[model samples]
Target: MNVLKCFNKGQPLPLRIKAADALRYLCSYDPVSQDIRTKITVIMAELLVLSNDNEFDLINEIMDDFVLKYAKELEPFALQLAKNLNIQFLRIAEELMNFSTTQNNDDKVSKEQLDKEYQASSILTNMNTMIITMTSEKDLTYALLGSVEPSIRFVLENCMANFISELMEILESFNYTMKCIVPEAWSIFDLVCESFDNFGFDYVLDYLQYFESIITYSFLEDGNKAGSNNDINAGQKTEEQKTSIKNEESKIISLVVKLLNEDNGENFADEDLVLFLFKLISLLVLKLGCVNF
Candidate 1:
C-alpha cells in the first residue's frame, strides 16, 4: 500500500480517514503473507512521521479505532512493539546525551538538524503512548496468555526476555517514562505469573529474576521503601497501592523461598506447588502480623 499517497499535504482529511482505515485493517486482520506485515510495518513507519502534525485528530481516531477493533488480536503485538520502541527511546536518549557532549565541540552539524533529530525521537516516544494503554487492557492480556502459538513460543520467550532486560537496564535513566509504563508492565507481570499454573512453576521460575528486578527497581525509585507506615511520608501513599505492591513483593518472595526450600532439581508436583505457595503466603502473613488477601 502506498501510505505516502494516502497522506496529502494539500488535502488532509479524506486521506487521513483512508489511512486510518488502512491501519485498522492491517492491525486487526491476520495477514495473508509476510509481505502484508512488511507493508503494515512501512505504514506504521509513515504514521510515526506524522506524529507531530498539528492536525493529528485523525491519528487519535485511528488509534482508538484499532484499540476498539483489535483489542485482543493486536494488543500483544502493540504491547511488545511499545516496549521495544520504549527501549529504543532509552538508547536514543543516551545517544542524544553523547551528541550533546560532542556537539559543543563540533560545528559541522547545524542546530536545526540537531533539533530535527530530537523532534524525531520525541515523535517516536509519543507514538509509544498508545502501547502503554494496550498493555493495561484486561481482555487483551487474557487473550495473549491464552494464545497457543507453539511455533512462535521460542521467539516470544526470547523477545520477552530481551524486552524485559532492556526495560530494566535503562529504567533509571527513564524513570518518568517508566513510571508511566509501570502499570502496563505490571499487567504483563500478572500474566507471566499466571503462566506458572499452565506452563509449570519451573517455567515461571526461569523469569522470576526479571520480575523481582522490576519490583526492586520500582521500590528503589519510590524511595527504596516497602511497608514502612511509620515514616510520615510513607503514610501519604494510599493503603491500596501499598498493599498491592506488598502483595507483589510477597508473591515474589514466596516463589523464591519455594525454589530455595525445594532445592532438589526435580520440578515440584502439582500438589506440592499449591502447598508450598500456601505455606509461603501463611508465613508472610504471620511475619507481617496482618491478614489481607
Candidate 2:
C-alpha cells in the first residue's frame, strides 16, 4: 500500500521510480495473491497516467513485460488500462508535435532537443507495442477498440503525415490479424476520405488500395477472381457477414462518389487516383450487380 501510494503525482520522481521497482519485484513472486496482482495492475495503470517522458523507459518495461505477464489476471482492467494509455499517448503526441515544430524553426538541433526527440520516439514505439500486444488478446482487443477510436481519429487528423501513415499501417496490421471487421475500422476509412485534402495523393492512393484489399478479403471467396464471386457460396458468409459487407460496400461507394462530385479539379485530380477509383468502382459494381450510386 505504501509502495502504491508512492506512485502518486505528489511523490518525488526518484522515489516513485524506486517504489515502482519494488512493486514490480513484489508482484513477480510466485506466492503473490491474485488480489495483490490485481491491485498492482491498478496501481501500474494509475502510475502510467501520471508518468512523463522521464519515466518512459520504466513505464515501457512495465507495459511490455509486467502488464502482459499478468494480462490474464488483469483482464478485468483492460479497458481502464487502454484508456489510461491513450491519455498518456495523447500527452506524448502533443510533446512530439511541439518538438517537430521546434525542430522546424531551428536551423540546428541541440543535444537537449535530440534527447527529447529520442524519448518521444521511444514512447511512441512503446505505445505501439502495447497496443499490438493488447490486440492479441480477444477480450483485451474488444476493450481496447472501444476506447481507442478517438485516439485513432486524433492521430489521423492531427499528427504529422509520417505519424498518420504509420498509424494506417498499424491499423492495417490490426485488421489483418483480427480478420473480422468492426465499425471502428470503418471510421478509419471514413476519416481518410474526409481528410483527403490534408493528405497527399500517394497517401490517399495507399489508403484506397488498402480499402480495396479489405473489400476483396471480406467479400470474396477463394478460387474465385475478385469481383467475379457474385454467387457467393452459402457457407462463405453468414447473414450478418453479408449485411456487413453490403453496408461497407455502399459506404465506400458513397465516399468515392462524394469525393468525385465535390472535387473542383484541385484535389482528386491525380490521374492514377482517378484510374484506381474507376477500377475500384467497377469492381464494386460487378460484385454488387447494381449499386444505387
Candidate 3:
C-alpha cells in the first residue's frame, strides 16, 4: 500500500519502478489477499488511464502476465479493471496495428525509430501473448478486431473488399500491404454505435466525415502511396482475396444503405452537423466521383 501510494502520488521514475516492481513481486510471489488483489487491479486499471509511457508499459506487462497465470483466481477484479479501463487498451492495440502502415520501404528510417515504433510494435510483437490472454483467459475471441477504431474499420470495409482490385488499381506500385489483421466492418459498426451511444446521432455524423479522410488516403489514381515503395504488380491479386473482400463489403453496404435510407435529414437536425455533412458530401464528389444530388 505504501509503495502504491508513493507511486500514485507522483514518485520519481526510479521510485515508481521500484514500487511497481514491489507490487509485481507481491502479486506473483506472495499470496496477497482478495482485497489486496482487488485493490491492485483497480490501481493497474487506473495506471492504464494515466497512459504515461512508463506507467502504461508497466501495468500492461503486469496484467498481461498476471491475467493468464492466475486467471481462475483473478476474474472478479480483472472484470472491474477491464471495465474501468474499457477500450483504452484496445485502442492502444488498434493504433499499434495501424502503425505499421504509416511507413514504407521508401521512407527514410529515422534515428528515433525505436520511440516512434515502440508504441505499435510492442503490441504487434506481443500479439501472441495478447491472443492467448484474450482467448484462453479473457474469453474475448475477437476482442482486437472488436476494438479496432471506426476510421480503420471504414478503411477495412472499403479497402479490404475491393482489397485486391483496389490494390491492383491503387496500390499496385506499392510493395507493402501493411494493412493486415483487419476484421469485417459490418460487425464492428454495431459495436461502434454501442460504444458511442453517449454521442447519439452526432457520432454517426462525425464518422461519416471521418470516412472522407479514408477516401483521400485510399483511392489515389497515380498509384503512389505517400510512404510506400510500391512496385507495379497486377498479377498478385488473388481470386480468393477478392472473394473474401467482396463478402465483407456486401455486409457493410447493408448498414450503409440502411443509414442512407433512414436519413430523411432530421438526424442532421443539429446545426453543428451541417459542416460535417457538407464536407462529407464534397469529399464523396471529389474522391468517389459521386454525382452531386
Candidate 4:
C-alpha cells in the first residue's frame, strides 16, 4: 500500500491513516511472509519515528486502540521485537518514565505517535499482568519457591527483582516526601505496609536491603483496618493451606534476616535500626507460634 512512503515522506493525513491501517492488518492477519515482515518492520520503525517526533496524532491514537484490543497477541510480539529491534523497548520505557517525571506535558506527541507509544506501553503492562496471572494459574507459589524455567527463569527473576527495587525506591521517596513535605510519616509507612500486605510475595527479594527491610519486616498491625468486620478467614484453610502459609512466612522471614545481616545494620540510623531489629525479633517470635515451629 506504499505505507512506508506515506510515513517516510510525511504525506497527508489520509495516507498516514491508511498506512497505519494497512500495517496493523498485515501484522495481525497476514501470514508472516518475507514481504509482510519487511513491511511490518518498516511500518513499526516509521511509527517509532513518529513516536519520537511527536507528530501525527492519528498514528498514536490508532496504535493505542490497536494495542489495547490486541494486548494478548502483542505482548510476546513486543518482547520479541525488543530483542530484535535496533532500539531497545526497555530503554524507551525508561525514557518515557523519565519524561513522565520531568515536564508534565513534555512528551506530547501527535495523536499518531501517542497511539504508537500506547501500543508499546500496553505490551509492558501486559507482561506485568501475565506474571501475576501465571502465579495464580499454575500455582506458581509452589513452583517458584526454589526456582523455575531456564528460558524464563532469568527474565522473570529480573522482572520481579526490578519491580521490587522500584517499589523500594518508591517507598524511600515516599519516606523522604513525608519527612520533608507531609505532616506525618505514618502516611508513607502505612502505604508501604499496605503494599506489603497486598503484594508481599510477588516481589522477588534480590537486594539485601529490601529483602531484609520490607520483605522480612514483621507484619505490623493495620490500624485502619483493625476493627473492620471483613471476614479474614472466609475460605477455610486445610492443614495443607496452613502449612503452606506458615512455610511461606518462614521463608520470607529467613530471607529478611539474611538481608539485614548483609547490611551490617548501617543503612538506617541507630535508633531506627534498633526499631527494625525489634520488629525482626517480633516477627521471629510470631513465626515460633505457628504449627511448623
Candidate 5:
C-alpha cells in the first residue's frame, strides 16, 4: 500500500515510475494474494490515466507485464484501459496534425521540430504496442474492440490516412476463432466502410487487400475444411454467428458497390485497381456466395 502512494499527484514522475516497476516485480515474483494483485492492477490502470506523454513508454512496459502475468485479474479493467488509450491516440493525433501544419509552413525544418515529430511518433508506437498486447488476450479482445471503436472511427474520419495501416494491422492481429466468436468483430469493417469517402483510392485499395485476406481466411478456408470433412456440423456456427457474418458480407458488398458507382468508374480509372476490385468481387462470390453489388 505504501508503494501505491508513490503514484500520488504530488510525486515526481521518476519516483512514480520506480514505484510502478517495483510493484510489477513484486506482482511477478512475490507470493502475493489475488486480492493484492487485483488492487495493484487497478492502481496501475489509474496510473495510466495520470501519466504524461513522456512516461508512456515506461508505463506501457509495466502495463504489458501486468497483462501478461495477470490477464484474468486485469480483465475487469479492459474498458478502462481502452478508454485511456483512445484518449492518448486522440491527443497524439492532434499533436501530429499541428506538427504537420508547422512543417508545411516552415521551409527549413529545425532539429527541435524533428525531435517533436519523433516524440509524437514514439507515443503512437507505444500505444500500438499496448493495443496489440491487450487485444492478444482472448478475454479482453472483444471488450477492447468495442471500447476503442470510436477511436477507430475518429482516426479514419480525421485525415489520419497514414495511420490506417496501423489500424488494419491491429485488426489483423485477431485470429479466425475470435472473429467467429466475437459479435463485435465486424464493427471495424463497418466503420471503415462508413469512412470510405475520407480515404483516397490508394488507401481504399489497401483496405480492400485487408478485406480480401479476412474473407479468404474466415470463409474460404473454413469452407474447404467443411467440404472435406464427413461431419459438416462438427464446427458449425450458431444461427447468431451466421447472421453476424452475413451482415458483414452485405456491408462489404455495399462498400464495393459504392466504390464502383463513384463517378461512373472515373474515380477508379486505374486499370490495375479496377482489376483488383473485380478479383476481390470474384473471390467473394466464390467463397461467400453471390455478390449482389
Candidate 6:
C-alpha cells in the first residue's frame, strides 16, 4: 500500500519508478490477499485515468505486469482494465508479436537486438502469466476473445492456437538465422493447447472456424498465388523466393501434422469432429504425399 503513495503528483520520477518496480516484485512473489488486490486495482485504475502520456505509459507498465503476474488475483478485473486501457493493451499485444528471431544481414545480436528481445520477453512474461490464469478459467478465455479491441482478441486467439502459426514463424526465422525458440514460450503454447483440449469437442467446435483459417494457409491452390503485376510481389518469383515459399508451405504442413498428433479427435471427441479431421487429413495427405500416422 505504501507503494501506492509514489503515484502522488509531487513524487520524484526516480522514486515513483522504484516504488512501482518494488510493488511489482512484491506482487509476483506473494499471493495478494483479495482486499489488497482490490485496493491496488482501484488505485491503479485511478492512476491510469489521471496520468499524462508519460505517466500513463509508466503506470500502465506497472499495472499491466502486476495483472500478468497475479493474473488469477487480477483477472476478475481484466475486462474492466482492457476497456479503460484498450489502446495501450492493444499496443502491448502488437509489441509482443513484433518480436522476431529474425536478425539483420549478419547473424549477430546487437544492443538494439538485445533491447528488443528484452522488451518482447517482458511483454511475453506478462502474456504467459495471463495465459496461466486463463488456462484455469475457460470462461476467461472467451471473455478475452470478446475484447472490444480487435488486437486484444487477436492476442487471445493466437495465444490459444497451439503455436502452429507462431511456431512456424519462429522456426522459419530460427532455421534461417541459426536462432533458438525460447523453450518457455513453447511451453506456454503447449499448456494452452492441453488446457483447451481438456474441453474436448466443445473446445474443438467453438474454435473450429478460426483453426480452419490457419489450416487453410498451406492449402492455397495454384490459382490463389496467380495474380497480376499489381500484386505485392509485383512480378514473378525468383528461385530463392520460390524456395522460401515452398519452405513456408513445408512448415505449415509440419505444424498441422504436429497438431494432429496431439489431437486425437476420433477417440474422445464428437463424431463430426472426427469426420472433419479425417477430411482435412485426407486433403493434407493428398497434397503432401503422406503424413506421420
Determine the backbone clash count of candidate 3. Answer: 4
For candidate 5, the per-residue lDDT at 271 reads: 69
Kindly report which residue stretches of model 1 are placed more than 4 angstroms away from their true locations once superposed: 1-181, 200-209, 220-235, 264-293
Q: Give a tens-digit lDDT track for model 4, residues 1-293.
A: 45556655558756766767665655555453335444443455565555445534455554544444444444434533333221333444455444445634435544434554554444333333333333221222222211211212222233323344433533333222222111122233344344444444344332223323332322223321112122322234466745544444455556446546656546445554455545655655653454222
* Order of candidate numbers by TM-score, starting with the best: 5, 2, 6, 3, 1, 4
Model 4 whole-model lDDT (C-alpha atoms): 0.40
Candidate 2's residue-wise lDDT over 226-262, tens digit each? 3332222223556685666567656667766776687
lDDT of 1: 0.43
| Cα TM-score of candidate 3 | 0.37
Q: Which ten residues in a row have the lowest lDDT in candidate 3?
A: 167-176
Task: Indicate the TM-score of model 4.
Answer: 0.30
Candidate 3 global CA lDDT score: 0.42
* Minimal lDDT window, size 10, model 1: 146-155
Q: List the residue pairs that clash in candidate 3.
A: 96-120, 173-230, 173-231, 174-230
How many steric overlaps are in each model, in order?
0, 0, 4, 12, 0, 0
Flag regions of model 6 displaced more than 4 Å: 27-35, 46-52, 55-61, 83-86, 89-128, 152-293
Q: List the residue pairs that clash in candidate 5.
A: none
Question: TM-score of the candidate numbered 1?
Answer: 0.30
Tens-place lDDT digits, model 3, residues 158-224: 3322112221211111111221212233344344334333343544443553344343433323433
TM-score of each: 0.30, 0.55, 0.37, 0.30, 0.57, 0.39
Overall lDDT per candidate, in order of appearance: 0.43, 0.59, 0.42, 0.40, 0.60, 0.47
Q: Record all residue pairs in model 2 with backbone atoms less than 3 Å apart, i.e. clashing.
A: none
What is the model-wide C-alpha lDDT for candidate 2?
Answer: 0.59
